[model samples]
Target chain A: MPWGKQETKPRLSPETIDYALAKAVADGDIVNLRQLFAPASPLRAWSPENIYSPKYAYLLPPSEQEGERLFQEALALVRDPDIAEHARAQLEKDGPPQLHAALVMTLADNAVRLGKFGAAAQAYEWLRVRPRMQEEFLRQGDTALDQNDIARAVAAYHAGTGLAYNYAAFPEPLPAVPDYQTRALILHADYPSTPENCVAMQDPAAFIRTALSYVFLDAETAARLDARPLEQRIAFTAAFVRRRDPDWDAFAERYRNTCTFVTAFGRRLAQDTPPAEAEDGGLAEEIEEQQATADPREIEARLLGRSIPEGEWWQYLKELAYEHPAAALFVARQSVGHGVEIVMPRLREDCPLVEPLGLDVTRTSRP
Target chain B: MNDAGYVDYFAALELTAEAKQGEVRKNYRKMMKDLLLSIGRERLTEEKRDRLLLDMARLNAAFYILRDNERRARYVEDRRRVIALEEEWRGLAETGGAGAEEARRQFDRAMRDFLTTYMEDLVLEAGRDRECVEASNWDRAHERHAGRVLRHDRHRHYQKILERLPFHEVTAPRVNWEERARVVDAILTEATR
Candidate 1:
């Protein structure tokens, strides 16, 4: 209907629609522009050829210049509220033949920008159902993709190209613990008092889930985690990440050196520096020179020697295993003492402690 | 009245969803008379007359679908999914916890599937009806599907979508959930309307 040959004279003179459009454009009259641009508008019957034909040449811009001016002016008034309201009214009217896919799409977008969500939805639903709009809708989607507009691309492709909703739509990682207090309430556990690791260190289940989502599981898999109890899932994740690293001792030695240096340096800096003048270079140089005299074993003991409850580190270690498996393996190697090569392999090969997690960890992992 | 893009053929003919074949025929005649009266009152050019015929063809298509009991039942079953998703979306919005993102994802998938399937049905039905095919200029055999046209149309829609979702990054597929949420919220408004 937007274009075709005119076999007979139009009911209204070409001047009627042209004059109306020119007036609307000149005055920035959004209401008239909305009606004039509508698919069902009598103006639609006047294709470029028809408007420029000898019969209507008097109404034409010398070479379509006048038409271009009107189009430019209409473009200038596109975001007007009256146009949006007219679009909304048409959508509410729910006439299938009157709706234009591109026009409605533009107005729907304006509604979204204006925070008129209800109006935008109306346009989306209109575009969604019309088979005639399929080609146009796909065009909208393709255009969005070409521009690298992922969210808009996803929206258009979902409605137009039938692109399925997937984890790819959610490219950003969700908060590690979206709402800490709500999760604690759900688990019926006490909230952690210390601030450092908070939920990640205190609750194994929470830590494992967040770590898996961040580093392993796709959004779909992470969202639909098994309904298993917390401890069981933690045990499962711990075993999953517990591969036998061939260079475990070497990695552990490096970690021990880093930890020792960090702990000793931290203590010296805390004692020697005033809170307000903490960045004083002279004090830092003197502490670094004095650091070699301090015993590494003694410093390690002083910092890590506090009696941790038996199960307090249990969850924290499992979480560590997910993020830094070597760290957890180092703790295990120290506890098992010296024969870890034999013990760890045997544990992996023979242990029936954890049930199969029954998940694909490689789904979103890079090839 | 148009729930989830389901064509209320019954409403098209001024009948209820439960209308039997006899009631459909009775109402179709009455509706046709009213349409003809309106068309007669207007002085139509050749193109305008053809355009108006599409309204008549749509009414005919509605009758075509509803006259058959099996098709009408299938229509109801299909529409039910859209309505169900609307309810599910509402519940997810209210709960607002871990399930929120996943639920919204599922709602989007269902809505897309329903709309695609419904559009396919409309296309297929129109293909079969001579009046609709003529009025709509729908060539079922030679029709360009989204898959075929996407290579050409992609650029245009991309610009449109970018304009709608402002400040969009053109390099990555990372979604701005807030902007996407507004559009989805608008879509839900229409679905529930």
Candidate 2:
């Protein structure tokens, strides 16, 4: 034979399809049932939803009338009370590999068509694809949420997403008159802030960063917060604040004012610093002299009416602000929109003026 | 109690304080049903949805206190204390007499107790945002930067929960304790005792 050998394929005729289904039902032959609904068989037309369509359009090669007749006949047989009872009894017993998988799939497809998604999902368990199960559940959740059925939505979301904790697990339809405990539980869940999960913040770094930038913490505590590894930030902050027992509003505001001073003074110092690089030769010496005169101690001495040799100004101011918030607040308040000259004159006599009078300076200074 | 720092639950539910238990229950159910129906019927924006949720939560809180006999009695008693204290403080400054200083000291203690209650309540309300982030598993929702933005939005939405609170008015300038104390002092001192 010059040509390739030809093999005859076994095709299922209508009579064979009918006889196979009847025998399977009567004998409880699930393997026969599997074969009938297998993708290679004509009976695969039964589930239109599972068909990929257009790309796998060839799967529906059977004419429309033929497909419909086969489906209607099979459905009628399965819907029969004696047959269904027998199939249920058979499913409970030990059976072939992938036993009744096709039977369950048919039931699922029918459930889907009837818009009974919950029942459909139950049937789909026989197919056993986890991702598909999750998708079905999430979809159900979204539907329930839209319908304003929060109880159903919460349950579906929990099942679909595998939430580690349930936020609101109150009784369904909500009791018309709940007991004290139930009301408390509902309030705890619905209220925006609960102490239930204080041990962990969603993003401690982001929160702490905001606090630091906003100057919601003192320089020392801010430094402490900065040094702590990412995970330990929230607990440390919560504990630190708890011990101080300071009113948070007052704390936040005091730092915010100090920040205003530090920022403005920092900018003034930046503008006064020698901008030209030291490598620029002759100007470098001039800049060095400028830095000398710019020194913080010299500025303080000059402010106190005592002349002193100039020194490095910018670095001193920054370190002073970082070390002593009182000095920063003092300079910030006195030197608003003015040069360093305007504020330093009273350091000797009015230095007592900056002694934090009624202000709680301990909050800003290092503990 | 149309004042900024107080909530009148009876007024919130559109009922007088003297409304019977049956009336309170009937109104709550009707309002809740309407709220839920509106949610279902409307295609709500994120902002609108948040507003609705907050309204629902506030409604729940109010109903919780009013529905119970013991809670309702306690709430009514607490409200009376606030009113009487405010009246006494106001009366001090208007009718300053021989014992004014002692009256002022008494008023200060009462004010601190009121402040403590409100501050704790505000903290509880603010803690909601953290709980929400945990529940939604929002940290893993997107890449780092995008996720942070979403979290910020979430926090801002939760902040509105605090804004709705009456205590925020009293603690408005949260930072300046000196000024706050002065103002509080002024309220009590300048009043006609």
Candidate 3:
């Protein structure tokens, strides 16, 4: 009535809650932020500014407001080591369907990045039954492989195959770590039982580094190690360095030098190779070609022939005894059975070969 | 003269006798799946249900016998005997000597008796192994499971005998012999194994 002045006031709307939440997040008010996004809170109903209306529904579906909040919370939790337990606890608990799914996905991604593959696999297992998470299962498998959880990786890949409609159409096949290779990695003295160690064994530079540390430390020997392929280098190192050193003292000295050389050589090689090629392209094609052409049977025969001169035939026989006891026994029988005169000189006597063959050497040696 | 004594596990499983272990397992899975689907539909007449049930029993028995290498070896041995006896019975029947019919009847009874005993023993052995597994003793369970797998690789020492035996010829009415075999199969299937 007085008409002294016209006064205007800022109006509060549904989005004001989101604006307030964002402010609290930016201010690092974790408690207030969590409360605003809690399932029972009225603020959880507030949608993002870019939500699709009925008129523009074709553009994109509306983002679930609760999922957005949960995703933000997960991001914050991942950064804070102290409150990370709460993040994991929240993930384990039930919440809004969309938020629960989003939280799990976030946790899975974070776990994979942090190399906590077991936790990542658990999260992916929960997501596996849900729609639109086939790729997540594949990621879980890859993460499992990084941890050398072969059985779990295989299971994840199988589950992913079941869920994915066009999985066959994908350009690249899933990576497979064969059983024998897994066994070799586990049993090999020089090779630490880690997937990263197995992967590093594939790199020529990495092979050189490992060889220099374990076998020969000279730059000339390291260069020679680099010239040959990684598999050959690994085989050579395993045969010459690891197996030949009878005593641990000699092995310890060799191992110490190899370690020192590996640190220096790895840095040098990293600088030599371009980041792009190192990351994606180099040596993969060459390695694939070598593997495609290599015959395992031929390699085994060659290795067997080579073992005779090195006086390592007994060691080879010992290794074979566990896997092919019948074959070993047959060889032992041939050496000492009806025609002992024919085969005795040919048989290696360094180790009691008959013992590993599961035969009594003294009894078998008699005609 | 009936094919009752000459039941080939391969023929029962709708596979070649020379089928590998993988093929045997695959056929078994497929046959089981189809039978289960039909049985689940609940649309069969009583007679049809009985026939299907008997077929299912035969299928199960055939798989068990053929899947284990040791059992398969024994089955192969018995099959050889049946072939030989059939051959001898055929020659006698064709010659038409005095008491030829009685001689043939003896041979037939001998063959039938052998088959019955062999099947009984198999079911009993499998039952004993199943009991070991059921006992929940991990060591015995592991040993039993491992023994079953190892039996898969048993050398076929009786291969020469298998090759020497002539292919069995069916002489009885198809439906009658099939019904008789089904009855035998049902008995074996219901055995504790």
Top lDDT prediction, candidate number: 1
Across A1-367, the per-residue lDDT of candidate 3 in tens digits comes to 3577633323433344434433333333323434444554333333232222243232221345334653356445444543333433442344521223333444444443333344444444344422234354545545554655544444444333333221111122121111221232222323222222332323444533543332321233245335544544443343333222334233233223323332332232212232223433233233344556532222222322222333332444444323322122122101111111010011223222223222223332211
lDDT accuracy of residue B177 in candidate 1: 40
Question: Interface-residue RMSD per candidate?
Answer: 14.6, 29.7, 29.8
> Which model is ahead, 1 or 3, in terms of DockQ?
1
TM-score of each: 0.25, 0.23, 0.22
lDDT of each: 0.41, 0.39, 0.39
Models ranked on DockQ:
1, 2, 3
lDDT of 2 by residue, A1-367 (tens): 3578643334434444344454333333334455544544333333232333344333332434344533555556765665555444443333221224444544444333333344444444334332354455445545544555444443443333321111122211110121222322221222112222211122445544533322222223244336445434443333223222334334333433433333333444323222222133332244345555433333443322233344233333343333332222223212212132222211122222222222233345321
The lowest-lDDT stretch of 10 consecutive residues in candidate 2 chain A is: A166-175
| CAPRI docking class of candidate 2 | incorrect
Q: In model 1, what is the error at residue A143, expressed in angstroms? A: 33
Chain A superposition TM-score per model: 0.25, 0.19, 0.21
Off by over 4 Å in 2: A1-367, B1-4, B39-50, B98-193
Each model's backbone clash number = 11, 21, 3
- Tell me which of candidates 2 and 3 scores higher on lDDT: 2
